[model samples]
Structure formats: C-alpha cells, structure tokens
Target: MLIETMSIVRDIPNLNQLSKQRLDWLLAIKQQDFNTLAAMCYQSHVIPYAMIRQLRLPKSNHYEKMLPSYIIQQVNIKNITEKDQVWLLSNFDALVTTQECIIFCEELINTFNKGRTPKLILQLIQDKCLPTQNETYWYSLQEKTKDILKKQFMISSYYELTAISRILSHENTELDLGFEDHERRQIHSRTMFWSNYSSRFNRVRALLPNEIYRYIETKLKRLSPQIECFDQDGNQEQSEVFIFELSNIIVVEFLRGELSETRFFKNTEWNAKRLFDDKRLSSAAIREMSQMEVHDHLSTWQYFCEKLLRQKLQVKPNDNLPYFKGLPPAVNTYDAKIGLPKPAHNFLSERALKLERWVELFWSAEFKTSKYGHQSGLQLKSNLYLSKALIAKQLDNYEEYELFIKKAANQGNPEAMWQLGKSMLLNRKSDAKIRKYGEEWIGKAASFGHVEAVELATRFKLAFIPYKVSSSITNNDETDIKTKNMEQEKAANEGDLDAMYQLGRRSLLKKGDLLSDRLVAERWIAKAAILGHEDALKLAIKFKLPFVKKK
Candidate 1:
C-alpha cells in the first residue's frame, strides 16, 4: 500500500506544494527509513524542515541543494533554528535565483535587528552573493547592505566612503559612450551633475542621514594626522597615493558645491602657507602639494586638470588640445595667446606659481640637507620643471616657458627635449643654425624612444642613432649601421610597428634608385598601416600605395 501511494504521489504535477498524502507518507516512514524519506522528498521536490529535523537526516550536498527551495517555499523566519540559518547563510551561493538570495538577505537583516548574532549578518555581507544579469538591482543591494554595515559600525566610515566612491566611478559611463553624440550628452550630464551642488547634497542626504554625513566629515578632518602617522611609520608612498585620492574626492565635492571653501581648505592645507596664503593656489595646486611622493603624481594631477578643463570649456573629449600634446598653439591665436578663458587663466596661473614654489621648496631643502645625491631628487626636479614649462606655454609666458623647458632638457628630460626642439623648428624666423640645433634636439629625443620625435626625425631624414652612441668609433660606423638595420629588419618581421615604420622611413631616406626605394618604403609602411600605426597609415596614404585606396 505504501509503495502504491508513493508511485501515485510521484505522478502528481505539483508535489512541491505540501498535501495530506505527502505529509502522511513522510510521517509514516519510520526514523530508520531515512532513504525512503529522502526519496520521497526528492520526488516531491520539497523538504519540510520539521521532518528533516525529526528524522535526523544529515545535511548532505543533496539536502543543501533542496534546502534553498524549501526555505523560500515554506520555512518561517521566526521559527527557523540557528543551525539551519547558519547553513542557509553559508550556502547563499547555492540559492537558485537572485530573487531568492534577496529574500534571504532581507529576512536575515530583520533577524539581525531582532537579537540574532551581528557577526553572522556581517559575514553574509562580506561574502556577497554572486551578481546576476540585473547589474542595477545587484549594485543597489550591495549599497544597501554596505550602508547597514556602516550604521552598525561593522565597517569603518572610510571603508564605506571608498565603496561609495568606487560605485560612483563605475556609474559614470564616459568610456562606454562610443559615439560623438552620446559622449557629448554624457559630458553635459557630468557637467550638470558637478555644477548642481544643492541637488547632489539633497540626494546624498536622502540616502544617508545627517549623522552619517557628520561622521564622514569628522573622519576626513582627522585624516591629516593619520597620514602623518603613515609617513612616520614608513608607509610614506602608500600614504601619498591615499592622500591624492582623498584630496581628489574633497576637491571634487568642493567643485560640486557639496563642500564649502572653508571646509575644503581646512582639509587640504597640508601645513603649506603657499597653498592658502591670500588664496594664491588653485585647488589642483593645493591638492598636488598635499601629496608626499613626486613620482607619477604630476601626471595624475595633469589628468585631473584635463577632466576639469574639458568640463569647464565644454570641450569635446576627442578635441586634440595643444596643451596636453606638448605643443603650444599657433602664435597669437585665441588658444596660444590665452590658452584659457579668464577664469581658467586665473586658475592655471595660480597652479603654475604654486608648482614653481614647490620646486623652490625642494631645492632649498636639498641644499640645507645635502640630499642632492639621490637620482630620485633630480628626476623630481626635472619633472617639476617640465610641468612648469607646460603651464607657462599655456599662459603664453614665452620667456618663462623657454627658461623651464631648457632647464628640464638640460637634465635629460626627453619630453622637454621634444617640446623645445619642436618649438625651435616651428619658429617662423628661426635661422639655419637654430634649425640645425633643433634637429639635433629632436634626434636626441628620438634616441629616448619618443614616438613623436621619431616621426619628426624621420620626416626630416635625420639618422636614428642612440644619444649614447660614441662618435669616436669611425672605423666601425658602417658595421654598426648594418647591424642596426639587421636588428630593425628582424623586429619588423616579428610584428613591431615602430620597427616597421623606422625601416620604411630609412628606405624613403636612402640615396638610391627612386622607384626601388619607393617600393621598399611602401611595402613596410603599408604593413604597418594595415596593423593600425597612425603615422604609418598617413605615410602610406601620402605615398599612394596601391593597397591604400583614397577616401
């Protein structure tokens, strides 16, 4: 009779819904009949929690798989045992659906509020469930859980802020907007978001209460001392990167109007009078000064400045700005004479002056301590000089621009060499001697593997020799040239675009039969063009190679 009943129950379509026969069959199975009960549960597609507990069935992998469905379908949160809750929490990834996980997390939080162990809830948050196709819903759930953790002091405010900043950064789809129209719209939206502080503040207050705001503010206020501690404890480099990101957030908030000038200034002063005295320093300068490490930090600051400048000037993302390209704009144009409008001009001027002061401060310290022995100090000095030169060019201060560029170039800064060389070559009234000097500078820059300088040198038929190559090896010069050509040929065959371009350029520059040289140059340059080398593509088009059709 029991076997006949089990067969009947198996034929039913909705055995997952508990019925009288299913319940009776489960009860009728003796405690020793564990296999029979398990079989019934498996066939029914349900496992009643009470029956499993009473029968002392082991929480096997099979049971764990079935448990999620049972919890979602039948278990009462209030009556669920701690052991079962632990099992459910531990196997959260086993939940068949995101909806099921969401339901379980909400219930767990409710349980947490009603005197359950906080550690369990915290652990659940730490082991976040796998995300689903619905990224928006998943990110929302993550933020909600993090907020709960923040409020309960399970996580630090700094941790929460970092998480929030990361989320915000991901939300900006600047890179994903591939089309010009979409990019413009995104930039406009970003501009609006940054310009409207009141709306931003209101949204923040809506999501996080005033107390949380005050807590974050207090933590930020105390960050300076903590950074100093990090420095003293030999984590200076790490601390400097941290301060760069932190100050970035603070400055962004101030620009957005979420933070007042006083609060922003207080948080970023870094005990530097040049930053705050008479408000001479721009926000970017102040932030730059607050950092301890000089390496790569200037590049970071420059990138940040570009973002801000794009927004302020409403410049399209792809608009090739001369400032960033290390080339000053045409003489006396709107950009060259005054690279920025009045407001941007004032900002950049302040920033340039502040950087100048930074170089002076470092020089003074080095002189006092006799610490000029380190290569890093000299590198830092060169980088600072280069930065100052770029700003001076933007501000149209030609004398200061030349002064700083020469200083950096003298220190073997390749970029400064390229810039100074390009400036000299582009000068309308440059004498033949000046042009020769400029070509030498460009050749030096090319030896340093400067891409643009190499392209420029190639166009001018200059030899691609390394700056360190000894001129006294007159007897072996031809042999060296042959060896270098062989190496370049090997690299080109191995698919190096730069090598291909160099070989093509060398072929074009050769004093040989024009027809044969043209074919050789076209063959190598065309290969590079097919591989997406920009200069190679241009050169290929200029040569009118048969494979390259005119647009």
Candidate 2:
C-alpha cells in the first residue's frame, strides 16, 4: 500500500524562490477564489499541485490510488458513506478500532481473515477496546461502566496494551474500560512487575547465551500459566521447581548476548560491575553457593562470582539490576589491534604524492593528546587559510591572499603555500615575495611531490617552476610576458594615498566566481585595516589580529 508522495529536492527557505511561472499559476487560482491552497511541498523546493486533493470529497472520477490528505497527515479519517465505511473497515486493519467504534467489527474481522493489510494486525491487537458510541454516553457510565470494562476487556497482560491504555485514557474516552478500584490496584502492581521483569529480562538477554532463549522458552512452557501465587496456607507457591534451575541457563544466555551475537542486547546497556551490585542476585548467591554447579566462559573471576550469586538465591530480576556501576577496566588479555585502520590502501596510494608532507606531519604525534596535537594544528590552519583565501579572492585582493598563504605555509602548511604562490603567479603581479618565497615554496612542495603545485608549475612559464614549464607555455606570449616580468611590483604613485591604499588593499574584496579561502579572507581584511578602512580596522581589533592590532 506504500506509495511515494513527494521527492526530496533543493532547499527552499520559504516560498520566495518558487519559480515565477509556478507562482503565476498559483496566483491565478488564488484570484479566482477556488478551493486551493499553495505552500511549499513537504521536502521539496518546488510546490506541489495547488489544490488540496486529499480534502476533496471522494468522487467517482477521483483516482482511488491517490493518497487522501487526512491519510497523508496520519489523521483519523471517517469521511465516506456508511456502506463504504463498512466496506473499508472490512478490508484494512489500521481502521479496526474505528470500525469497532462505528459498529462494523464484523467487517473488520472479515478483513483480517482475508489477509489484507496484514502489517496493521499488531497495531489493532494492541489498541483493541470497547467502541466509543458517544462522548456523553461514556461520561454517564464513567463510574458505573468503568469497573465492568476494566475486568472483562482491559485484562490484557501484554506491555503494548498497557501503554495504549495510558494513551487512550489521556484522550478522555474508553474503548471498553475505565479505571476501576481493583483494576487500578492491579494495573499498579502489573506495571511494576512488568517494568521489573522487562528490565531484568532485557539485561539477561544482553548477557545471556543465544541457545539459552530456547531453554527459557522451554522453561516458560513447563511452568503453570500463572507464574506466581500464594496457596491457602499463605506459603508463596510455585507449580514447578524449574525456576530454581533457570539461573545457569539465564546467566549463560546473558553472557553470550553480551559477548557474541548482538540481537538480544538491543536497547540495553551491558555492564559486569552493575550486575554484581543487584540485591536479588546477592540473596540468590548466598542460597545457591552450596548446591548448583554449572560452568562456562568465566574468564574473569568476577564474572564467576556474579554467576554463582544468581544461582544460590533464585532471584527474580527487577528493573534496577542492569544500571551500570562504572566502566570496566581494560582486559589485559584482549588484543587492541583487532580492527583495521581507515584511509584505505587505494585511497592512500592515489593521494600519496600530493599528501606526503601532510601525512607525515599529521601522523607524527598521537592524534588524541592533552596539549596542542599536530592534527589539531593542521585542522585549525587549513580552515583559516581556506576562509581567508576565499574572501580575498572574492574581493579581488590577491596581495592579501599571498600574505596569508605565506603565514600558513611557514607553519608547514603545504596547501596554504601552494595557494599563496599560485595566487601571486596567476594575478600576474610576480613581485619579489613571489620570487623569494614562491621558489622556496615550489621546491619544498615538489620535494614532497605535491601534485597540484607540480601540475601548475609544469604548465605555467613562471620563474619558480619546480620543473620545466610545459612546452605549450614556452612559446605563448601571455606566459612569456609573465616569465619576463616575474618580479614586477604593482604599487601606486607617491602622495596618492587613495591609490596607495587601494594598492595595499588590492585583493581586500575578491570579485567574480571563485570559492572562499580563509587565507585570502584574512589577507583582504588585514590590508583594508592597514589602509584605515573603518570596518576593517574594527574587525582587526575585535579578532586581535597578530600584527596589525598593536599598530
């Protein structure tokens, strides 16, 4: 019955960027005052059909397959002729309670028998109850009928039923029951016992053996339908002595669940120390210490002692037993090198030449350390350069980007150094810094075999080429002029402070389509501050810039 309704699409903050064409179409409907509402499609940048199709009354012409609006919103839907309602009730289990309330239980049962909508059977079983004839009628019977319903219809022993009762009660209606005095007491005790049993059983499942579930199933079968009761003599009695024998099997199952297959440990935390502190297990230990004898994976003596404790007292587990005492100490016998490291061999090989220096520097020290780790340093510097470079490039301020690149590279940052040299050469300024630092940078980078710098140097006729500029660049006028003026300065005329300031702040604001670079961003911001750009100066003061703030 599942059907795809809407495809996930681009992010749309609101309805603002919905295409003009789509908007115009929707506006036409709005102006006509049709029963239409326009909103962004759930999980899409585009609008869905303008009409609220689900709210439309079902017509012979309407497609049966289209999802109803109420259904899409997961609301309880009851819109149809009585005959149609009865037919639907007979075919779908999701509407079982709705059918029962509407006096169509026979139809619902027929639907269940036909095997249509089998997935909804569990939901129906869990929510089964009396029908809601009228709210006023139920209110009149609140005191009188509440008792009768609690005894007959609300006696389910299942956990899901108990949870559903709490939910139904909040809506202030009864399916078949109200909270009667004895039933209230029964519910309190049942909830307590159920919570306790579930908690311990879950913990046991987490710690126990896989095969032990079979043993438990066999044991549960052997016991009386009623697990515990008192006889006329007021002695706490059991139909079988099997409960006493269950400890070894339960403990085995618990340990297996914790150490092996993970299916049993679902939604439970497994801890050895907290399992020891349980009072029930302590009492059981005192009793079973002399008699029961069974043994398995007690690699640690602590585990053995805890197992023995459980056997002696025949302790019935409760909710609090599994709360952890603390973290277990590392097992000295277990090898730490069981799992393979990440950054696969293929991935490393592909980037080995480009990432050689970064790899060495990043791995030189343990990643997790108390003080400034190399990994932390690299992460911080990489982010910084990327942001600055992006901003400077966006503002067309290549000079500032060059400075930021130098600072990042001097800190052993290959990416930053590569960016700095690349920006200087590309912008065609090629000043002394480009020659002095650029040559040294390209050499250091190529030594480590950084592919990006090598590729650029090989293709461009710059004085600082790590290897020969490619054959294509040697004959080209554009590259030849660049090579000849590889050390030209681009400054302004003397006394023209505005032009001088602009020259100093050339790449302060990047222009055109380029990605953000932190180094470039910082450089532009810094250059503008040096020229007394008010906003830039304030930013410098705020961030406590390394050199300019003091000045």
Candidate 3:
C-alpha cells in the first residue's frame, strides 16, 4: 500500500519529487468525491509556485523576477503553433499561468467583439479552473441572475496574486472591459461576498473540505509547540519550515483560510514560542507582535512589511520556460527557493496560547489547572513531563525538577521512569535502596520501550534477553528486538489481526517520539482496533484512523 501510494505521486507530470511526496500523502487518502479531489490537486499544484516566489525575495529584484514575462512579450514569434501555446499555458508556473490567463481573457474579449459568445466553453473553463465555492454553499441560484453570475464569475477568476495586483495596478486590455474599467467594479459587486478576485480565499473556511481540514490540522499540531527566542535555542528553522509547510497545507486542504482571528505568531520565528506566565511578559509579547517593521529610521509596510518583501522575492517563472531558448537565468532555480518561509508574517495574526500552557507546566510549584482545563484542550502528552523535567533542570531548579520527574514517572512516562530510576541508582545511600527503587521504576520504563532501561534491567537480573516485558513488545531497538518486530511485520504484512493488535501497542509507547510515527503508529493502532485492542481501539476510533485492508 505504501509502495502504491508512492507510485501514485511519482506519476505526476512536472512536480519535483519532494513536493510530489508531500502532495501524495495529502492527496492519497481518497475523498470519495472527485470534485473535492480536484480542488485538492489544484491547490497542491499552485503552492510550489507560491513558495518559489516567497523564496526568491532576499537576493533579487523585481526586474530579475519579471524576466520570464518580458521575454514572452518581446520574442514576437508570430507563427507559434496552438499545440505549443497549450503546452506553454500548461507549464503550471505561476508567472506562465498569469500571462496565459491574460492572453486567454484577451482572446475571449476579441471573439466576443467579433460577435460570438462561446458561453458553453467559457462556463466549462470557469467551472474547472476558477477558484470557486463548494456546490453545497450556494443555497439557491436565482432564475433572473444566473446568466449574469456566469459572466461575473469568469471575469473574477485569476491565476495568481501577481495577476490581481497587476490588473488592479493600472488599465490593461485584459483587465479592461471593452476599454472601460467599469467591468472590474461590476464583477466585484456581482460576486457573493468578495469585492476582488484575490480576496476569494480570505473567507474560505466555509468552503473547505472538513475531513481534509482536520487531517492537515492534526499534522500541524505535531509540528507546533516549539520554543523560539532570537538569541537562544530559538525555533527559527522549525517555525520557518512550519510556516512554509502550513501555507501549502492550508491552500491544499483549507483553501487559504483567514488568520485575522488566529495567532499572529504563526508566521514569525522570532520570539514565537515565548512563555507568557508573567503578565509583563505577556504584555511584552503582544507589544512585540504589534510593532510594525522598521527600516533605517522609517516605517515602510508597517506590520505588513515582511510579507510584502517575501512576495517580491519569489522567483517568477516568466523566462524559465524551455521554449524561451536560452541558458536558464544564471541563478534562482526552483530548487534554490520554493515554499521556504524567509519571513512567516504573511500567514499570521492571533495570539498563541501554547506558550502559556508550557509556562503552566514550567512552574511546577504553581501546579495551576490541576487536572487539565477542558477549554484549553491541553493533554498530558507522552514524555511531556520528562521534557518539562529537562527544562526545569536547565532553569537550575533541581529541587522541583525531581518532583516533576517523579510526576512524569507516575503518569507512566517511560523516560521519566527510566531517568528517575537511574537517578536513584546514583544517589541512594544503600545498595538495597538503590536496587529496590531502581529495578522497580526502570522495569516499568522497560515495559514501555526504554532500551537502556531494558539493558539495565537485564544486567540487574530483573529482565530477560530480548525484553518482551509487555504482552505487547515495547522496546523497538532492532538489534535486540529484531526478531519480534520482524515477526510482527511479517504477520502485519500477511494481515494477522492479533499481530496488528500487538504491533499497535508497541508502536504506541508513551515514552518517546523515537517510538512514535503518528501516521504509521495510528495505522497500526487503527488496524488493531478491528481486532479489539480496547485502549488502542478507543483512540483509533476517536482519531478516525484509516482502517487497513485485511488479507
């Protein structure tokens, strides 16, 4: 199945392999409706070009980026074949799409002026290529306005942000309505809510596919919750990567949803994950976020400055087309900059609540929100306490750090159990005390897949070789546990329900991420649910994990 999924993505025409893989995972889960699938494919198709533009800004200028469009305009190859033009339009490059859309609209206007309205053909193109609402959203199409709606929808469709910006900047035949700008106003007023084409996705949550939105959001949860500071061990790379990944994810899954009510920090890596346990600190974070971008004693684009710059930096696909007939621009390959977030601000706008939760745990002494607040949706994740213990120690609060470590151990955190046990081994005065507590806690940790705990327990005569400590194996150290994982893999490959049950538990160790690959882990757990692994089944059902096929 995995190989089959890989093959599906590999066959996509021009997308790079990495992008194809990302899009494949996002797209492989069949939605049952081809319209939804088409929307997903279209979004996935557009993001690479969007990312390329974001990446190109730091080192280049507008002229360099506009090179592609300039060449197309200048080269006047009057006898270009229709087949060649179709291929050029289908390049899937943002700049190429923009130019083609313009040319297409112009040709349509010309044909209309020649006394022919290809309404059927235009309607098909609008239905397929335009960014549009899901069919369910249109409550009713009035009999009187249906014809006008079609025309307005056609004039409203555009290929890129650049296209909209260009059309709005000045008068052009493509944007002009029979040489009058009044058509633009009429098209904007005719749409359901948007006053402009670029604003179509601004309120897209209503049109987004529910299942895909939840799925991508689940992935986003895994990537978020990192701590970032400008000078310290900041999460600049992770935050940047996340912003890039998220924009692509939303466009493909959530339809470029709004951020006016979301955390503004979503796009910025600098001080992104700062804790605001302190009131002064919370105020400080808000102030920093509120501050506008400044350049050499001048306020430029204000809070929007970074977003503007990145859009400018993106590599335009104008001259890079193969048919242009020249060595590719000296630099700016799609590989060099595409979908990387230099500045994450274009996608952000609300206050982050995650850091407050981190701070809540950070202050073990406070122990606020004793059993978890339902409103916050914060849960005690596996190894979370152990991670907090490490942070506590870093803050030099060793006294409370031990307390936090023990808390994690009590919560069945394998790392905490193993670590607390190791600490006892070194600190306890008597051998009996050392052996008693050390073996107990480490044994518990070993049951959850702590390899070192397994080795330690084995050396202390508390466990056997291969460490099959649970009814389900936990330690996944291939060297020692290879036979078991292989056996499970074999049984799983052959569709053995019992094997899936065991593998699911094994993959679901609450000790560490080293044991967790949520997609694979969830799949195993979901498979086991069919065989009735009680806890695994509960979570699988809750998460709506995909059920694997039986042999």
| Arranged by lDDT, best first | 1, 3, 2
Comparing 2 with 3 on lDDT, the higher-scoring candidate is: 3
lDDT of 1: 0.47
Residue 374's lDDT within candidate 2 is 23
How accurate locally is residue 503 in candidate 3, as Cα lDDT from 0 to 100? 70
Against the reference, the lDDT scores of all candidates come to 0.47, 0.34, 0.39
- What alpha-carbon RMSD in Å does predicted model 1 have with respect to the real structure? 17.6
Give Cα distance to truth, residue 537, candidate 3, Å: 28
In candidate 3, which residue ranges exceed 4 Å CA deviation? Answer: 1-387, 394-396, 410-412, 423-437, 447-452, 463-551
Q: Rank the candidates by TM-score, best first.
A: 1, 3, 2
Say which candidate scores most in lDDT: 1
lDDT of 2 at 529: 69
What is the Cα-based lDDT of residue 7 in candidate 1?
A: 48
Residue-level lDDT tens digits of model 2 in 1-551: 11121112222335444443344333434353221222222222111321223323223212221222222222113332334343233334332244223232322333333233233432342244332221211222222233343343342222322232232223232222333343333323323323323323311211112232233334231222212221223221111111211222233211111111001101111112223233233212222222123322211222223323344434344323442121133321211222112223444344333333332333332132222222246645654554455434433456766566666676656666676656555556678876666666665554333545554444453234233223443345545445433312122222222233333222322223134444554555566567555555654554455435425
lDDT of 3 by residue, 1-551 (tens): 75557656667689876576455433433322333322332334332233334333233333233333322321113444444334334332344444444444333333333233344434534543343533211112222222244355542222212222222223442333232354333222222111221322221211112332233334221211121122222321111101111221121111111111112222222222222222123221332332212111011111222232235322122223322111123321222124122223322211112322544443331223232211121225434566557545533558868887988888767778888888887774648867678778988878756756765665566752233444333354333456657866776767665566557655454335453465577677787676555555655655567664334
Q: For each candidate, C-alpha RMSD in Å?
A: 17.6, 31.7, 25.3
What TM-score does model 1 achieve against the real structure? 0.37
Q: In model 2, state the lDDT of residue 318.
A: 37
Could you tell me how far off, in angstroms, the CA of residue 358 lies in candidate 1 after the best superposition?
7.3
| TM-scores, all models, native as reference | 0.37, 0.19, 0.25
Runs off by more than 4 Å, candidate 1: 1-65, 69-350, 353-387, 394-398, 406-496, 506-522, 542-546, 549-551
